[model samples]
Target: MSIWWSLHLRREAASVPLARRLLLGTMETAGVDPDISFDLSVALSEACANAVEHGGDERAGVSSSAEYRVTAYLDGETCRIEVTDSGPGFPVVRGRRGALRSVHSTAEDGRGLGLIEQLADHVHYRNRPGRGAVVSFDKILKWREGALLKVS
Candidate 1:
């Protein structure tokens, strides 16, 4: 069976943990491997932190009512999560391979994207310029029993 959920949260520090806990509970209830759940939970925290820090009205100094969104989808074999924010989009950077790179190890900030990329099997970022930014990632899920059996 496939499981999915979505949450619309205020852009605040407290909201980050709330999202993580919900994800954790979902995975645990679904019998997802602990290691996989931990990794995804950490990555989810990072994504939420980025949205709280960079994707909010605080940067613009106009609206105190800022919020973010988190969505998760879990099939029998794969888990996908998306975190979106209603603030200025992320800055664009290109890696040596000409791919969009949002992380800078040399810098003191913006390390979450790097960590997210390392943890997830697939990572994608979408920026709506003046509207918002979205960070989406997916990871292969494993059951404690054995390899995931394909439904079909």
Candidate 2:
């Protein structure tokens, strides 16, 4: 069975875990392996945390209407997730590996992007300047039946 879900969440710290829990439950119900599920959960948490912390207007606090969106798609063999925020777009730098890099080792506040990259098989970042930013990643899924597949 294929599964997909999208969540429109307020830009608040409390909403991070709510998104993570929903993703985890969905994966578990789909018979996703625990290790893969755990990795995706951590990556999702980091993405959600980044959205809550950076996906907002220049104002000092999030307004009641401020929101971010998280979407997940699982088609039995692969899982893809995208997190879109309403805040100002972030800077993007290409790392030596040609992957999108958004963190500095010495910076204490921006480790989420790095963690997401390490955990997910593929990562992409798009900055919309005045519009907003999008962070997307996908991982190949393995089932207990020894069926190997790729997202197409």
Candidate 3:
């Protein structure tokens, strides 16, 4: 059996807490252990936070009219999570993907995706059908002595 769940989040910082809680509850009902659930929560929170903070600027009215969608599911041994926004998709700078994994604390922004990378086993970004981008990640969950161990 597989557990699938999703939620629509408005573009705001407050939605981070709600997303974490929702995912936590979903994972619990799906029989995910507490530690694995917490790790997933952190990864999801960072993904959503990146969408809200860097995907577009609220003060600039860029994504003010848009919304974000978050989805998660467990298929066999892998836990999948996706964060999609209505704003125009983020750009991929040439030859910068590797740098993002190690560079942080720079004067400018761009570390949110890096955080997601550190936490998630496999992460990718793509454009949705209509507009905006979807960042998704999958982490392998293993049963270690009958408890869930996040084995990215």
Which candidate ranks first by TM-score, i.e. highest? Answer: 1
lDDT of 1 by residue, 36-129 (tens): 9999999999999999988875656646338889999998789999999877677777778765667668787878888999999999997876
Of the candidates numbered 2 and 3, which has the greater lDDT value? 2
For model 3 the TM-score comes to 0.76
Where model 2 places Cα greater than 4 Å from the true spot, the runs are: 59-65, 92-100, 145-152
Structural similarity to truth (TM-score) of each candidate: 0.88, 0.85, 0.76
In model 1, how many backbone clashes occur? 0
Question: Residue 142 deviation, candidate 1, in Å?
Answer: 0.4
Which pairs clash in model 1?
none
Residues 1-152 of candidate 2 have per-residue lDDT tens digits of 58889999988899999999999888777777878989999999999899888888766355532899999999857899999997876766678986556878679877888899999999988887666789999998866443333233
Descending-lDDT candidate ranking: 1, 2, 3
Lowest lDDT block of 10, candidate 3: 94-103
Model 3 scores a C-alpha lDDT of: 0.73
Which window of 10 residues has the lowest lDDT sum in candidate 1? 143-152
Model 3 alpha-carbon drift over 4 Å, by segment: 56-64, 96-107, 128-130, 144-152
